[model samples]
Target: MDGLLLQGFFRSSAAWRVRIALNLKGIGYAQVARHLRRGEQRAPDFMAKNPQGLVPALEVPGQGVLTQSLAIIEWLEETQPGAPLLPADPWARARVRSLAQIIACDIHPIQNLRVLAYLKRELGQEGPTVDAFARHWITGGLAALEQRLATEAETGLFCHGDAPGLADLCLVPQLGNARRFGTELSPYPTILRIEAACLALPAFQQSAPDRQPDAE
Candidate 1:
């Protein structure tokens, strides 16, 4: 295997997405723990790799550093032929991408650690207020997902089809974040069902936040 290094914080959902994809592809890589809460991602070394100072910066063997979980997963899909993370059909691929973006682009950003920290530190929000903010946005996203997944015939054992793929990568991590923030998941039965199926697989299990080396 060519040298691959993933610099990420354990609890980071973005990092978790990449971890699941790498595991699903059966790729072996070295991990560099970046403690986000301690501002380690902002340090000079990590910043050099990702000027955005974000976790989940992947250093590929010859392609230089790949930032962002979605892009890294797309690179893996294009380069590594093993266990593909995306659907083959064009329309199916678009559907999968749409579901993945719902979390990655819509939900995850507002509930991220930096955003929550800003709410508390910069805006002077109480703990309960920040928690409420997270739950509100996550719940809204889950509500939209629930309506689609429950009614859409395309949704299967996973988000798009029988096999776990890109959508699952995004879904599982956001579910983890929702649970962490005490968001009520009972309303999203389809989501819970899909989450259970994904969790039963070794890739998702091994890539979980609690299973990571730097997990607190």
Candidate 2:
């Protein structure tokens, strides 16, 4: 087996997504902590591996380095096809990607640490105001998700089907952020159900922020 490494911060939802993918694939890898809070990700050494200065940069023995959580997970799905993260059918795969992007693209990026930091530092937002910002976007995104998941027949125990796939990976992490920022989750019953189902699995549970060694 070749050496594998994951460079990531514990609290980053993006990083958490990749962690879940790796666990689901049953790939063993070493964790190298990059403290996002301390601007460690921007340091020259870490930047060399990931110019984006982002969490969840995966280092593969033969493949060198991989960046971006979604891209990395797609790579894993391609390289290790045994435990597939995507659906077999083309339409189903597209639907799963759509759901995943609703959280990853629409929700997570707006509420990520760097954006929140910008809100406070550059925009001069107070704590409560920033919390409100997070809550508003998260609630809005989840509301849309709730509507789709509630009505769409494709939504099974997980996002797409009974089996947990890419969408479930994206959903769980955003829900974690929703809870942390004091967003009211009672409104989205379907979202809550899916989250409950995902968390019940060890792969999701073990990849949680609090479970990581660098959690603070």
Candidate 3:
């Protein structure tokens, strides 16, 4: 890979984050699809790249493989030059990161496919029960995020400002997962409005799950 090779599955929200960041930064990259449900991530070649066998592993030219979506996003924000994913002001940056973490750390960890599969295959959870499990956490997290975004002065057209940033990248994908689990979204108008604003941009729209070559 002369530039960047993004190793990810089309449906992965984590990978979706990286894709949006990369697009926002205007970086050129190729996709190396690793089908998570098919266990392609566990294949030896990819394992050498990411020991955790997760998607969204970025193969930088000489820097080797970078894992973890948020870490990858922060790395891009720091290194890349196009759009700034985090605000320059320290306090503003912290606020954006805090909002992003609620989705990336709290909501996603609970509702992610890994946990969902374990619930069904390992614990013998029924389909509806597993789905409810996902919706519960996503709903609660969105409620908090909605409250913060709605009331906070920092929030603008996107999560932190007029332009989309790190928090917006995290929000858009999690909302996709929320819809997948059937979470009621009418309550989070701020979040939904931000999502609408994000989708209007080319970077977010092009990085959508269905637009990926490996989709389905």
Looking at model 2, which ten-residue stretch has the lowest summed lDDT? 75-84
lDDT per residue (tens digit) for residues 1-216 in model 1:
568999998999999999999999999988999998899999998899899999899998777899999999998999896788998999989988988888998899999999999999999999999999999889988898888889999999988879999999999999999988999899999999999999999999999988988888
Q: Please state the error at residue 170 of candidate 1 in Å.
A: 0.6
If ranked by TM-score, best first, what sequence of candidates would result?
Answer: 3, 1, 2
Candidate 1 stretches with Cα past 4 Å from truth are none
Highest-scoring model, lDDT: 3
- Compare candidates 1 and 2 on TM-score and give the better one: 1
Which digits, one per residue and each the tens of the lDDT, describe model 2 over residues 1-216?
Answer: 358899998988889999999888888888999998899999999989988898889999876899999999999998784568999899989989998999999999998888889999999999999989998889999999999999999889988889888999999989889989999899999989989998899989999998899998
Residue 130 lDDT (model 1)? 98
Every model's TM-score: 0.98, 0.97, 0.98
194 in model 2: Cα distance from truth in Å? 1.1
**Higher lDDT: candidate 1 or 3?**
3
Error of 1 at 117 (Å): 0.7
- Regions more than 4 Å wrong, model 2: none
